[model samples]
Each structure stands twice: as C-alpha cells, then as structure tokens.
Target: MHDSQVFFELLSENTSKEVWADSAYRSEENEWMLKAGGYRNRPLNKRAQQSNRRKSRIRARVEPVFGSMENEMGGLFIRMIGRARAKTKIGLMNLVYHLKRCASLWKSRQ
Candidate 1:
C-alpha cells in the first residue's frame, strides 16, 4: 500500500496539531481526514512558484537535520524490537545530534 494510505494511522500518535508533508500526500481523502481530525495541514504546493518558494524556505531549515541523521548518524531506520527500546534509542540519538550540533557551533565560534 502507498505510505499515504497508512500515514493517517499514526496521526493520533503525534503530540503536535500540525501536519506537514509534500505533494505526494495531497489528496481529497487526506484533506478530509486532516480537517476532521482538526490538524493544521501544511501541504507543499506543487504549483505557484512564489508560494512554493516561501514554503521551501521553511523546509530548508528542516531538511538538513533529517539528512544529517540519515547520512551521518546512520539513518532513521531503527532496528530495535520494541517501542520502549526504540524510543530510548531515538531519544539518545536525538540527544547526540544536539550535542554534536553544539560542538560544531562551539568550534565555529572559537
């Protein structure tokens, strides 16, 4: 099945009320679902360069963090067996990423 089909299944799990995704996730069903669930949908605009550019400006800040996690930090695919272990692993990884980011900034400032 397409990822979008199952994407909403995890919607309730999110702590935030906003949902951001690319054009691929844009559909009438998804839009209806988001509305019904009271989520602020941040759908990427495929047309209109001006608006898309504005949207990309926000995405710019987010893409790198995921890229760094995937390439430098061994990716987001957790291999752990259970939810608790996976959460712990992800929490530690997130902590490490922040620590690494701090170190980078510290060195740059020195």
Candidate 2:
C-alpha cells in the first residue's frame, strides 16, 4: 500500500489527499502520516469494522466488476515476460471488456 501511494504520486504529479483500503492496510504509522499530510484515510478499522456503510456498498458493486474481468475477460494472468508486454496484454484485455460491455448495452437497448 505504501509503495503504491508513492508510485501513484509520482505518476499523477500530485499528492493524494484520500485513500481507501482494506483492514490489512491499518497501521498507526500510516494513519499518522496520512493525518499529517491532511489525507482522508479510509482504511477499515483494526477490528475490521467499516466506518461507513455506503463505502461498503460501493465496494460490493466494484468487486463484481473485477471478478468479471478475471473470470470472463481473461485478465487474471499475463503469460508475457516483460513489463511492456504485460501492459499491452492488460490493455488489450481492457479494450475487449469495454467493447463487450458496449455491445451488451446496445443489445439491451435493441
């Protein structure tokens, strides 16, 4: 989680002021750092308690999209060797997902 924040900051060229994470990301040091940086920390509590039910509902909706990507769109693994090749594969996978999603929407309207 820490490394990901650094990478995101580097790529975005801006500091992230908000983060949402699971209970595994809970830590006093992380919390302190986020607070000091004026970030809105949304990690689940140590006892796995959710602070907001709305967030949980949003996560429930988002998880199924990832599950569909892994199961239906073949995004679970990349057989390629290099980072560039892996990125290309994932990009194509995402393109396919979008195409299929659009087709489904069009068909539903028809």
TM-scores for candidates 1 onward, in order: 0.52, 0.46
Q: Which stretches of candidate 1 lie over 4 Å from their true place?
A: 1-47
Per-residue CA lDDT of candidate 1, range 36-107, in tens? 989875544567567879878988988878888899889999998999999998898788888999999999
Per-residue CA lDDT of model 2 for 34-57, tens digit only, reads 677677756466555654675789
TM-score of 1: 0.52
lDDT of each: 0.84, 0.70
- How many residue pairs clash per model? 0, 0
The segments of candidate 2 whose C-alpha lies over 4 angstroms from its true place after superposition are 1-52, 57-61
Where does candidate 2 clash, by residue pair?
none
Query: In model 1, how many backbone clashes occur?
Result: 0
